[model samples]
Target chain A: MSTIPEDLSYTKEHEWVAGLDDGRTVTVGVTAYAAEQLGDVVYVQVPEVGAAVTAGDAVGEVESTKSVSDIFAPVTGEVVEVNAAVVDDPSLVNSDPYGEGWLFRVQIGEEPEDLLTSAEYTSLTTAES
Target chain B: MSRSTPLREVHEALGATLTDFAGWLMPLRYGSESVEHNAVRTAAGLFDLSHMGEIFVTGPQAGEALDYALVGWLSALDTGRARYTMIVDGNGHVLDDLIVYRLAPEEFLVVANAGNYPMVARELTERAGSYDARVEDRSESFALVAVQGPKSAEILAKLTEADLDGLKYYAGLPATVAGFEALIARTGYTGEDGFELFVRNEDAVPLWNALSEAGAGLGLLPAGLSARDTLRLEAGMPLYGNELTEEQTPFDAGLGRVVRLDKPGDFVGRAALAERAAQPDQEDGPGADALRLVGLVARGRRVPRHGYPVTRDGVVVGEVTSGAPSQSLGKPIAMAYVSRSAVEAGGLTVDIRGSHEPVDVVDLPFYRRSK
Candidate 1:
């Protein structure tokens, strides 16, 4: 029963990409399904602003009470922005995973081709749960 | 497929997140584990400990049999009292940490960790071959429910007519709870004042419902194993797999007091334990160079997890056994086994995923409930 927004694109690693329609600067955050599975989030590490990254690169880490996970770059680009609010308070990732819990933003380097649609992401999460 | 407890359906109905633990499917959390942990620390929290193993040893020689099988002098334990003890191999390595409750003059209940009970039962049976004791693994027929916190006594008092004021810590008595038969033991793993109700499997749901209703206004939540881990960690309790292992002894974990070498008869690991007790500080002894267990509080926000290495100036000194973001301390805390030399030299850090996070080595038990 995770919220999968129709406007967003997802990766197999559970990161959701917003603004794919714009194809320039896109926002990224972990899906609600990933956050719920991690239990209570305690710490978050996001890539530094202006760092260059590629798709599937482990740029940051999300640590919950019981375990930790890697945050991968959904698309290749330079890190445009990082969420200081979520870094300061990691619980935001659990409280508002789709909104205020956005991890970072990246400028698109190439056309993203492997992203999953909302329907596809729903099936992926369903299979996982 | 993993085994399911009798409360599995009830947990599923509550929308709990189920996880496999020691081959059993049990609830990890219902809503938030932190909230459950805090509730247990402040008010109360209910736990389904049915996954734990319950073995009964009964007969005229039951006490003597346990006295030889376990590390403690159980034969000297009075009826209605419980002892925190362990079953060790001949080499003095820990098999499992157990809580033995003497229910009658000739009946004793041995509660063990879920993963080690079968072996414990088999070992106890083999050890009691010459004695007149009968060992029965009654784990499948029993369900354990624990109400833990400062207000546990008050909540339990409403459901049973038993004398709550008279029950001392680490004591148990048979009582009728909510019109069901149960062995009410004043024992808990959360390091709080609590009662563990051992009832038949069929009585679990209704008993849970009754306790929930009685504790409605007193702030009791259905807690899971995740919360239970943090609570016990803060209390400095050693987990069986994390702290006690087959390669280590109780003395190595800094819990040698539970071993009674002065007891009259010969017991398992008597010779080895006596030798260890005699020359505890000898450099050439068995565990002289081995890592000793200690508590660590992270100087940074990142939590240290199991199997992480403890380092001193980039040199690996020990390994973290258990760790978590403590709700009470508001900082990450961990229990680890560090070499004696590293402990004396000070300046300890946990290598958290390749980052040497500075840590302060405090005394065991990062948090203690104010009495």
Candidate 2:
């Protein structure tokens, strides 16, 4: 019931990091499990482009119907671009969390080698349920 | 910390996501919140409300006791009726908002919020000493099941001998429903005509099954706290934690009319309420900046959350108390307490992120029954 692509790196916070086709940037988004549990994300405050961010820093906040959660960054990078479409339409995260609803792309100077693998992320989120 | 409702196993069986709210392992939802919200709005939905605290007050002076315990007149209630009242503290601040049902001439059942059960019971019992009333906590021995929505009455009418329609809103009738001896109350949190059934703990499962079976034809689904929240929000109803709390008085929460100050005699917070009412509507009441509850509807899909600042002309004015993208309204809306000056200034704005967005100061019940 989960889709965790092996091509990406993961975080304990359930964010997925995929190296973009440009190679210099990595696309970041929350995993399907995290989005599902968040329950109808009503608001997303994503960081703007060119904002400097460190690994494990809260990049933004996502609010659901019942509670609010901080979206964490898995790699040390500068925000290259934000997905305004997803910010306008939060249900996209619920529907296509990994693909079109990708949170943002960061031009990371250093991608964390300690990032979890897809298998590890799946195991973690499954245990969380 | 220990007890689980009869629906616990059923919830887990149906793969519901469970949460420990008020020491009860209640299901927040079985699946999607959107689907759950739609289910209750479209057809019928069942709620396991056994976690609600039920206290019985009996004896000749029970009516007098409750009148003093609550900010409501209990002496005037008919046997088969219920009233929504607030249990206030010494400051007239709400301890808990509850529904008191007069079951008999001298007996009443006070239903309280799950989180404030012990405090409410203790506060009430202490005040009940002067009167001839004896208090009993029936939370563990009894179970509550609420079937709500337009289809609820149709499904239940087939099983209950009582005249459900005759029992108007906020009224109760002693009757047998689905062969279970229960008190059928035409009262609910959702803005709909429905019944809340109170039964023995042992009979909960069967009653649930019978209701489920009968509801099958009416598109009924077992709803959880998720649906409950959205449904109540659509109805513009306030939650205990969000709208009403220890710091909030019923009068400030837009429930001032529920207090009958002129009625015979003293309540727990009578002097305080009288003082509050008599004080010239202070922009900021004594010892604090002026604050009053108000609603906000964001223009777009963006939801303004709790603690987010409400601004006007680039000045921070208020903070969001509770907010959600309403399933029924199809837009993001919020409730917050703004300064009386800000509210009177006509137009207002809420600071969503860095941008200040305008908010409409309208009447409550943001969503109305269109059907």
Candidate 3:
């Protein structure tokens, strides 16, 4: 039912991490599956740029017409930038979750390791009932 | 533990995203909230209302018992007729708002909200302790399905043997639908030509399938809670948590007419309502430029959200109660309580987010189709 893009890795929290490299920045956003579940995106509490975040720490929040959900950090890094375009147009998250819907870009802190690959994430999501 | 309705499997098969509503796992939406909402307005929609509670009361003095318990005098209602009434406690606070259906001279069925089922049942039982009537909760054994929209009757007419044409507004009758016995009530909350069918849960599967098959030509899609809210909002109906609450008096909720102070016998909240209505000053009184319930036709594309500030003459008059981009109306429409005295000129400006936008105040029932 939910489509997982092949180029990005995933977290158990349903967030997607794109690209790699120890020092290069990687983009992070919610999966299509998560966006479809939350009906009508209304507001997104944008995270502070240049703030450090660790894995499992909350990055920001996304408020839908019905509820508000917290976005978590998939890996430890510094948030370099946030998508202001999506903040102005919340529906973009529902439309292009991977491209224009990228929530934020984080400067990779150290060696990127133990991240679930596209195949692994696919199987991980598939194994879920 | 929470419970799932009979249409749970059916919703999952249709790829509906489920949500927990009042301890019931119900479908929040299918493809899109707006699409499902528009489908109910333009065509037809089938909703599973099985989570609501249906309680039957029958005895020699059932009418008297109901009149004592309910805010409405049930004895006055004729057979096959239904009336919306309120249930209040001794302090006049609203316990629940429900519809009482009279089936016979001494038999009445009270349909209550799902979350307030136990509370209503328990309260009724406590009061019925001194009465000759009996209360039995038939919620679990029965399932209610709502078929609402302009094309509802046409599709339903083809499936049932009962003469639906003879059934008028607020009237109900016994009928066989989809080869199962059901109480067919020609009433709905969607403000459309609709029917509420009460059938045994065991027979719900067949009935749902039959209705779906019969409704295919009518373009009836299984609607979820999202559509239900938009439809009810357009109809000027109030949700319990939003417009109606325990702290709010009935008159404040725009339901003052339902309370009958002149009627004989002392029902709960009647005296307090009378005293409050007779008070020299009422908060709900037509104060000069005081905020009242009015429809706001947005000047721009920005859809107003609840709690948004309503500004008139650079002063905050009220806040938005409900708002959305209406699919049928083709614009950003909203309802807010604006100061009646201050907003006498009609057009009021709403401070949407950070932008100041002019809004016009109009009477409710925003979208009504000429029959």
DockQ for model 3 equals: 0.21
Runs with alpha carbons beyond 4 Å of true place in candidate 1? B282-288
lDDT of 1 by residue, B1-371 (tens): 88988888989998899999999999999989999999999999999999999999999999999999999999999999999999999888899999999999999999999999999999999998899999999999999999999989999999999988999999999999999999999999898889999999999999999999989899999999999999999999999999889988888888899999888898999888887878756322345357788999999999999999999999999999999999999999999999988887889999999899999999977887898
**Top candidate when judged by DockQ against the true structure:** 1
lDDT by residue for model 3 (B20-134), tens: 8889988888777776776677788899899999999999878877877877878889999999888888766778888889988888999998789889988888777778999
List model 2 lDDT by residue over B109-160, tens digit each. 9999998888888988999999999998888788999999889989899888
The DockQ values of the predictions, listed in order, are: 0.91, 0.64, 0.21
Better of 1 and 3 by DockQ: 1
lDDT tens digits, residue span A3-41, model 3: 888878888778899876444888899888778777777
Q: Which scores higher on lDDT, 1 or 2?
A: 1
lDDT of 1 at B310: 97
User: lDDT of each model, Cα atoms only?
Assistant: 0.93, 0.83, 0.80
Model 2 chain B: weakest 10-residue lDDT segment is B280-289
Minimum summed lDDT over a 10-residue window in model 1 chain B is located at B280-289
